[model samples]
Target: MKKTLFDKVWDAHVVNSIENGPQILYIDKHLIHEVTSPQAFQELEERNIPVLRPNQIIATADHNTPTQDQHLPVKDLLSRNQLQKLSENCEKNGITLYELGHKYNGIVHVIAPELGFTQPGITIVCGDSHTSTHGAFGSIAFGIGTSQVAQVFASQCLLLTKPKSLRVTVNGTLKKGVLPKDVILYIISKIGTNAGTGYFCEYAGTVFENMSMEGRMTVCNMSIEMGARGGMIAPDETTFEYIKGKEFAPKGTEFDKKVAYWKTLPSDEDATFDKEYFFDADQIEPMITYGTNPGMGIKISETIPTLDDASFEKSLNYMGFKAGESLLAKPINYVFIGSCTNSRIEDFRIAADFIKGKQKAENVTAWLVPGSKQVEAQIVDEGLQTIFEAAGFELRQPGCSACLAMNDDKIPQNEYCVSTSNRNFEGRQGQGARTILASPLIAAATAIEGKIPDITKYYLN
Candidate 1:
């Protein structure tokens, strides 16, 4: 029987099926971090259970770790306790951990792929919504709650109901300055945040085929924002190329064998999806969210929508934005270009190349954080650090900096920030903070202009 890519992977992972309940799906890789695993570890301790497969689990400290002064102890009391507990739990359970100040440490999602721990035709689970980022390599990866994290640690398996498959295809050439981030923001706007409920999305089309691995990861990382269970792009030559020579990836003949299997993981020609959506890549412009929700987005050149719905009105009020107003030239106080969603080397390269020899607006404070230490090293090697310094931007230590309000990187209340991170919900960056989510290019241009500008004019010309 012809099967969609999701079916091919999910079915392969199903160890057994209950009569009228969920499937017992085997997880090949289980990732944990500070925020969610503490409770799970405590639960295991109460039950007097040892981690059934310690080697299969990998822990990292990112969510609550400070982006600066990593060598010193965490200043926040709660953050310090969480990191300490995570280290203790991992040590007691015999699991590998990438602690703070460790060279390999980074956001769980970022480090997993960079280390080649995320592979095609496998099942990966993490207590992080952005775990979907690993699906860029054609794997079945998704987030789980604390209980589910405990379940995986105890048995290396999860109970899950099969999700319906949705195929989203984007064909044609993307216009200049229309990045993968713009493509996803455009999709969420058209489909609404709740449209993909109970569905796992398979991204297919010429546009996705031509996208780089980092671009694919960016698209999949935002799958949860649109209510999808997860999103995936089938493994191809580009996927294999990215995995090759990575620390955990298969080598020599083993790699060749793995590639042979991965090559067959794409959806068959006769496979059908439960739902399908097609987009014209040419129509997608550089997108930014004007309202609180990620779905409340518009093209950079478009005006805010004047909807009669109360929710729309509430969003505009929260954002201090008026209907029918253009975002262009709206003054911004902060510009953040980092996160699991857009802090990869490719993202920094785009921003650095654009900001070279240009100075940031005096009124704007810009933060350029790499996603991982490896990415930070790459930046230094490529001389992007020099360009950033020349442009009046400072490179911060790697972590989930400014993506959330967890640490000292929080944006001040009511201050508008052009950020490349995911989500623009009310107070997502800090209490009462206003977030304008955009691509790295848009963020960099906004920093240069101290407001949202026509990025095409600033960079392309």
Candidate 2:
């Protein structure tokens, strides 16, 4: 029987299986964060369960951590208490933690991949929804609920019914200005949010194969938005190269041995998927979300789709956008350029390349937040910070700034913001704040022009 990459990784991690029922899957890594881990930790404490395999657990402070003033104490009481609680829980449980101000500190999804804690053929679980980001390296990674977090803490295994397999293939050359963010936004827009329900999606074909490891991560980061259990890409030389010298990666001979194993984790040529979708890369362009949901997307050059559904009308009403209207030149007052889906060095470099000598529009309040301390250092090292500063953009410390309204950085009510974060649901940035999801390039251009720009004009000249 030919096994798909998902089957290969998943089967290898199965600890036990009930005939015709759920399987007990061993979790190779358990990642925790301040927001969701507290309840789980309390649950474990209440039940008198010791954290099993503390070495397998990694904790970070994000989601609720302040993005600015790292040296000062956190100002938000709830955020401060949650972060403190997380630190206390980790200390008590003897789990490794990357707290705020720690050099390794970052969004749980971002830091793990950068440090090589996320690797091929592993089963990774986090309380956060974007845990699928680690699947870029051919891993079977997914998010779990609070009870599942406690379950993992107790036994490091999860009883789950196997998800059906799906494959999304995109062939041909991607047009200029199209980033992995745009590709995913385009996919969800085409397939709708419910298309991948009950399936593990494997991203295959030349477009994905040609993408950089960071790009692959961006693609997988939003898989959950499409209702997939998770998303994965096959391990290849690119995967090995990205993990080669990472902090937690295997050393020297061990790396070579690991790569040999990873090479065999790809789906067999004869493997079949339960469902498949094919797309032409040439048809994809820089994409942006128009309505409240991620599936309500349109090419930058196209007008919004006129639909006759009540939910669609409600979304349009909330966004203050009418059907058949183009987003070009729609005045925007805010721009956010960091999140787990982006916020890597490559994303900063791309923004800086466009922002080099240009100045931000007087009307735009732009914020460039790095995903991790390491990425922050890279921004300074590569002088990307200088370019952004010169353009009047504020560079903030690492955290999930404005991606959610948990921190100080926020988009004011009823204002428009072109953001690089994954979701654009109503009030995702702040109470009543409107979010327009786009690639870093689109976000950068929006800041430069103080509104949405004609994306077709970008990277074409």
Candidate 3:
């Protein structure tokens, strides 16, 4: 019987299986951040249970962290206390921590893969949903709740029923200006949010094969948006190359041995999936969300669809949009180009390349945020910071800025923001804030245009 990438990795980590019941799955990495971890730590402390695998746990402070003023004291008392508790918990548990202002500090999803903590054929878990981002390396990664966090802390294992396999294949050359973000938005728009429910999705075909590591990460990061348990891409040369020479990656012969194992982790040629879908890449375009959920997206050149449903009307009403109305030239006030989904160095490079000689519109307040401190350093090292500053884009420090309204950076009520983050749920960016999810290129273009433009001319060639 042929096996899939998910099956291979998941089977390897199974510690015990009950007859027709949940299996005990070993977790290779447990990532934690300030907000969700404090409760889990407190639960363990109250019960006098020690963290079983401190070595496997990595802690960071990101959610609710202020994007400005790294040196000064944190202003939000709650945020400051959470950060302090995270530090104390990690120290008590003997787990390694990358605190705020630390070089390795960043969004939990961002720092893991960049620092070589994420690798192929491993099971990773975090309290945050975007933890699925690590599945770009062919891992069985997903999010867990606070109780599940305590379970992992107690045993470094989870009792879970296996998810069915689903594969999405897209072949053919991607059109110009259609990015990885666009490809995912296009998929969600076609399949809707519930298509991947009760499934672990595997991305396949030449389109994913040809993507760089950064692009693959971007694609996998949004897997949760479609309601998939997680998402995966088979590890290949690109995956190995990205993991090599990182801070925590094995060196020399050790790395070669690891690669030898990784090469065998891809799905077998004759493997069968529970469900499969194929798409033509040429049909995809630079996409943007028009409604509350990610599935309500359209090509930049298209108008809103007329759907008859109370929920549909509710979404349109929240967005202040009408059926059959084109978003072209619709004025926008805020634009954000950062998140775990698209805040990699390549994303900034794309935005910098586009905005190099151009100035942002006077009416738009554009914020450019890196995903991690390392990415922040790369921005300065490569002089992308100068280009962004000269183009009138504010280059904010790294955090989950404007992606969610947990921190100071927010989109005002009823104002429109063209964002590169994953979700566009109503008020996701702030109270009553309307979000239009797009690729970094679209976000940058929106900042320059001060509105949603029919960027067909720029997108076509």
After best superposition, candidate 1 residue 147: deviation in angstroms?
A: 0.5
Candidate 3 TM-score versus the reference: 0.99
Q: Write the per-residue lDDT of candidate 3 for residues 1-461, one digit (tens) a residue.
A: 89999999999999999998999999999999998998999999999999999999899888899999977899999999999999999999999999889999999999999999999999999999998899999998999999999999999999999999999999999988889999999998999899999999999999999999999999899889889999999999999999999988999999999999999999999999998889999999899999999999999999999988999999999999999999989999899999899999999999988888998999999999899999999999999999999999999888998999799999999999999999999889999999999999999999988998777878685
Window of ten residues with lowest summed lDDT in model 1: 452-461
Off by over 4 Å in 3: none
Clashing pairs in 3: none
* Per-residue lDDT of candidate 1, residues 1-461 (tens digit): 89999999999889999998889999999999999999999998999988999998888998878989899988999999999999999999899999988888998988999999999999999998989999999999899999999999899999899999998999999987888999999999999899889999999999999999999999999998999999999999999999999989999999999999999999999999999999998788899999988899999999998888998998899899999999899999899999999999999999998899899999999998888889999999999999999989979998998999788899999999999998898888999999999999999998998888887675342
Which stretches in model 1 have alpha-carbon errors above 4 Å?
459-461
Q: How far is candidate 1 from the true structure (C-alpha RMSD, Å)?
A: 1.0
Query: What 10-residue stretch in candidate 2 is worst by lDDT?
Result: 452-461
Model 2 alpha-carbon drift over 4 Å, by segment: none
TM-score attained by model 1? 0.99
- Per-candidate Cα RMSD to the true structure, in Å, reads 1.0, 0.8, 0.7
lDDT tens readout by residue for model 2, 74-182: 9999998998998899999999999989999999999999999999999999998899999999999999999999999999999999999999999988988899999
